[model samples]
Target: MAGGGRLLRKAFPEHWSFLLGEIALYSLVLLILTGVWLTFFFAPEMSEVVYQGRYVPLRGIRMSRAFDSTLHISFDVRGGLLVRQMHHWAALVFVAAIGVHMLRIFFTGAFRRPRELNWVIGVTLLVIAMSEGFAGYSLPDDLLSGTGLRIAQGIMLSLPVVGTYVSMFVFGAQFPGEDIVPRLYAMHILLLPGLLIALVTVHLMLVFQLKHTQWRGPGRSNRNVVGKPLFPQFMASSTGLSFMVFGVTALLGGLAQINPVWVYGPYRPDEVSTGSQPDWYVGFLEGALRLVPPWETNVAGHTLMWNVLLPAVVLPGLLFTVLYVYPFAEQRLTGEWGGEQHLCDRPRDRPVRTGLGVAGTVFYAVLLLAGGNDIMAYSFRISLNALTWIFRIALVVAPVVAFLITRWLCRALAEAEQKRLTRGQESGEVRQTVEGGYASDHRPVTRFRPGAPRRPIGPGEHTGTASQEPSAPTRRRR
Candidate 1:
């Protein structure tokens, strides 16, 4: 028991900041646990089957077993709905927590020097996470997910010569197929998850090696992380929080109806809703699609595709590449040698870096909003063309504005700090009388002591003799 306790103590080391990574880990665990349970009942095969389940409304429907099993899980299986929901919610939380944690690392400049590789690993994990979500969501073969897949296919097909071949390979046929679900199932359950676990393991290992970034304060450095040790308090808190997160996710799953396959019906290729949207994480890509003008040209009897390819493949790739490269890019821009700098209480302490981050965020946000152009236009009763144009304009302008605003705010903060340093901090307000164009109640400056040695003015200077004597005496004698 002592050995076990010692091991536990050495492992966790109580810290709240450590909990950020813990949240992600816990979420992933929940996802896997719930996913394993779901896999038992879920039919990965894409064979067509008639739905004759307890849900009276959707009985006698012809659909793929994958979809049918999903429906069964939704309406028939005991607590299946809750399990499914928990799985989904956990996935969302997992992705979201990782993103926030990465951002925390970024703004604090923790990704500098020795930790740069870990930053790359983190970005790769994010890509895998999103891919996992995409593949998992598509497993049910529902309308919404199918629509998303179509967009994905469109993106895939937008590639140059190999586009059609890639799409065919991915889908296993033209559009809906018997093999696609199984392939995606393989990816969702096996490939992506394996990659995720590996990446996460590396990420954690790197974190432990690098140590946690500390909060900015006097004498505090990256090496000195502030928090309770892992033994009893951190472990207990982490365990309790994990259970709490699991419970909340379960509760939401039970109460909230998400991705109702019945409502979406089956995947239909020809039909598409006016405002079909994917989950929030992938919304930025969709926004880019909405904003880009639909243009096409043919050269040498092959289509030169810009509209589909750019938003789907090129843009997303660029975004991910930029994210992965940002730490290095920043290092290059600053020209400052890297060192451990954990605490960053003020964003303005790194003004240029902060501005860049904000600008990138603004750019992402603009693209995200642009993804829902149809919804926005329909809701506002505006022309789709106008909406697209507006987004395109905002895509260019918003980042500039965000950069300027962030820079200005940083400068203002620096100015405030400078003022604080130059003028003594006011404890309480005191009225000052205007006399000799100076404040009457100001404190007087004290002169140097009589025996204090004066600074040497030049070579052969004396301390307190002729050279140090007041010049006013000589002037008066003359």
Candidate 2:
């Protein structure tokens, strides 16, 4: 019972950036809540049925029962559309929060030392989150989701030897088989969400087990944490944050429209929608699929779609592999293995790492932009092929340029910080010496705790006034 009281008194560092993880946690809570509400009205079966909903356009149309129930949720159930939108928006925010949170962790080197396993868990959670999102969207069995699923099917079928087997295993037969919707619903509602919750629980336990990494500053060190207690301070703030997150998501769900399945019509094997793109998280894969040049290899009468396999399979595989390996890799590369890193490094202090992170971000951004090449080409009246070629070139070139620029910027920033610490801040007062030379007084910046109180004139802060300056340059000086 000695440590029982410590549980309620756990300290959490107070920084705006730290809220990213909290936002992700709150978003997950919203997802689970709204998702549970949805399960009551949603029918995840893929059996063929006639749509008899109030939506006039598709009233008499033939559609799957899954799509029909989605329509029912949208029209028949009270506040169903609102809950659905909130759920969708919450999912989007959840993915985004996790992304920025991970970025903050990576750039600050919070993933090092004892936190390496936590970093891996975070990466796995991201992968599962994306998979969960994919499954969630596909469950409605609408045309847009069907197209995404079709792309997924193609990606699977693009593999050389086991492609067919994989596709069959997934769809329970071939693409657009009868069993796909039910299977997707199960994964979306049951399997993926369970994994997410379990991984998140473990991530939190590890975070609590180890000391939090904070910015290096005065009164901050590896052994001690500086922040509020968990009992009232953090818990109160976190509770308010949860409501805010829920309210904002609910507002977006009610006021803003998303994934209007009825408008898109039901899934059909023969049809495709123009200018359709997957959600933003999935955009990079779509872009990669669009940008890669067509190349196929046939070995022993088996055709291999390198174009699909490379971007969709190999690229994402490598990206996630890098994520899982990065903390250990950095520790090894920096010759800091087996050393704990409790103080988070400012991005400017770690130029190589900052540059690499920027480079990877640029690479992802290029692929995301490429994902919508068709839409861009159409909207701007540009040639699709030309845009694709441009993206292909940029995809290879942009990351290198970003890396060089980021490294230079980091170095420049580091140099600037050194100068700042060396010379201190200008105190806005000009002082004249007996020799008639005037110089500005510089105040040494004693503390560097960002987001902390700056008033009350703390130690090392310049409190000198004009009245305290040497009067008449000490007229009696020899």
User: Relative to the unseen true structure, what is the C-alpha lDDT of residue 33 in candidate 2, on a scale of 0 to 100?
Assistant: 93
Error of 1 at 24 (Å): 1.8
Which ten residues in a row are the worst by lDDT in model 2?
A: 469-478
Off by over 4 Å in 2: 431-444, 448-478
lDDT of 1 by residue, 259-331 (tens): 6778788676777754567878888988888777778999787896788778878888898898988878877
Residues 138-244, model 2: lDDT tens digits:
99999999999999999989988898999999999867999988888889888999999999999988888785676654455677676667777778988999999
Best-matching candidate per lDDT? 2
TM-scores for every candidate against the unseen true structure: 0.86, 0.91
The lDDT per prediction is 0.76, 0.86
Clashes of each: 9, 1
In terms of TM-score, how similar is model 2 to the real structure?
Answer: 0.91
User: Which residue pairs in model 1 clash with each other?
Assistant: 13-229, 13-230, 14-228, 14-229, 14-230, 216-343, 286-371, 287-370, 287-371
